[model samples]
Target: MMGWDQLAAFVVVVAALIVVPGPSVLFVVSRGVALGRRAAVSTAVGNEAGMLVQVLLVAVGLGGIVERSALVFSVLKFAGALYLVHLGVHAWRHRKELAVTPEQERTTRSSAQILREGFIVGVSNPKGFLIFTAVLPQFVSPDSGSVPVQLLALGLICVIIALISDAAWGVLAGTVRGWLGHSPRRLSFIGGASGAVMVGLGVKLAFSSRP
Candidate 1:
């Protein structure tokens, strides 16, 4: 068990990390801009749900195996990269659809599909797995209690903070979407831009090396 002092410190560190825009944040923003607030928030929830699964795996000790094996890590990374590229290309091709009514945009994709997509992205994120493997153990106090319990607790805290932060970003982007919803051209542009961002993120992730 982590003490109040240790937990507080961990929260501060995690909050700082969450505030900085990362892959998760960017993905959520894109969803908000392209889909709407509901989709963005749902994506955030699904992403965090996937993150929670990772935390559970880490607590059970499988995370270390994935972290230590370069082949496994690379495989996961490429899978995520390819998935993002696939998503980006699909979005770009259907960008014109976004120019329709905002109501239509909101109803374009079911919540389940968006959640599934987000979950896959979250789970396949190798960087996120590495972060958990590397950071959670640092705060574990072997003498205090079970290391797995502590890791789970710390990981939950991280996810909560991220959810709140990512949701806020999504809401903000959705608001922007509302403002631009009037113009079909601008809406199409937003769709295109969001797709481009996702594609760029995928390319960047593909080139990233093990750290």
Candidate 2:
């Protein structure tokens, strides 16, 4: 097993990694700004759950095996891209409905829907697989005892840090969103911009070649 110093170093690195805004974090912020902080936190929790799944899959050699196969890589990539485009379209199509109103605030997305969406994104995200496939293995050593256990420990720490950081962002976004509620026109602009970004990301993902 890695020493205390080594584990602490890994935690620091993990924290730094989470600070970089990824799709998951962006989703939470947008949801928070558009919906509420509660929704954003729920989404982040779902995202963290998805991330835990990725960590576990990688730990057991499953992620490596799938990544090693060119066919599997292509399939996963395309599938992820399709999902992204689907989400982008969904957001764009439902822009009006998602636009917050006093009454709309009374009801929010279901828990099942939140978790389902979160799990789907985590499982389907090729970039996530790529990150763990490359990053996790780098810190692991056969001499350090069970690689899987180390991975799980590292993964949990990563997820915890991300959840906290993202929740913080969600709170901040939610505050801004609350203040802007009266300005529907400005809110609309923000929503449109976020939608466009999602679509652009989907397009980029769709066209990316296997590494």
Candidate 3:
């Protein structure tokens, strides 16, 4: 069993890591602004779902393989970045259409589509996997009896924290988008800007130097 002190310490470290804005947060914000609170929340769920999967993989030892293999890491990295860029381009192309009344927006996307996009974005993000590989094991102790179980417990904690934090960001951005929606022109601007940000994130990730 993991000690209470270890668990509390782990919580603090994870909270600190999550509060800092990262790809997941940006993705949620983009979805919030582009779609709405519903979409944002859905995306957050899907992204965390992806995080959950990565954590599970780490618990099983697959994460270490990915971390050790430069080729694998690069492949995952580029694939995720390219996907983000694709989504960004798609958003830019349909910016005018996206800037619509709330009612009309609902018709533009189904729940499943939003969920799938969020899942893909979350799963593709190599950073989450890297964090699991690098950071999750640090808090674990051999004395814990079952390292895998402890990792899973810690991972779940991380996911819960992320869902709360990222969901808040989604709600906040969605509110701003709602306010901007009063003007069709401004709505269009927000959509385009969101797309631009997504593209920039993709490009940055694609070109980032591996550690």
Clash totals in order:
0, 0, 0
**Cα-lDDT of candidate 3:** 0.85
Specify the poorest-scoring 10-residue window by lDDT in model 1: 99-108
* Model 1, span 20-135: residue lDDT tens: 88667898999899888888999999888888888999999989989998888888888888988888888898888987765675577788999998898888877568768987
Q: What is the C-alpha lDDT of each candidate?
A: 0.86, 0.73, 0.85
Task: Give the per-residue Cα lDDT of candidate 2 at 95.
Answer: 60
TM-score of each candidate?
Answer: 0.96, 0.86, 0.96
**Higher-ranked by TM-score: 2 or 3:** 3
lDDT string for model 2 (1-211, tens) is 7778877887787777777776667777876776667767777788788878888888888888777898888777677667666766776666665556756655655767766766666566675677778767777888978888977777777778878987888788878878877777767666665566666666777787766
| Runs with alpha carbons beyond 4 Å of true place in candidate 1 | none
* Residue 133 CA displacement from its true place in model 1, Å: 0.8
Q: After best superposition, candidate 1 residue 18: deviation in angstroms?
A: 2.5
lDDT of 3 at 1: 69
Regions of model 3 farther than 4 Å from truth: none
> Candidate 1 overall Cα lDDT vs. reference?
0.86
After superposition on all CA atoms, what RMSD does each candidate show versus the true structure?
1.2, 2.3, 1.1
Clashes of 2: 0
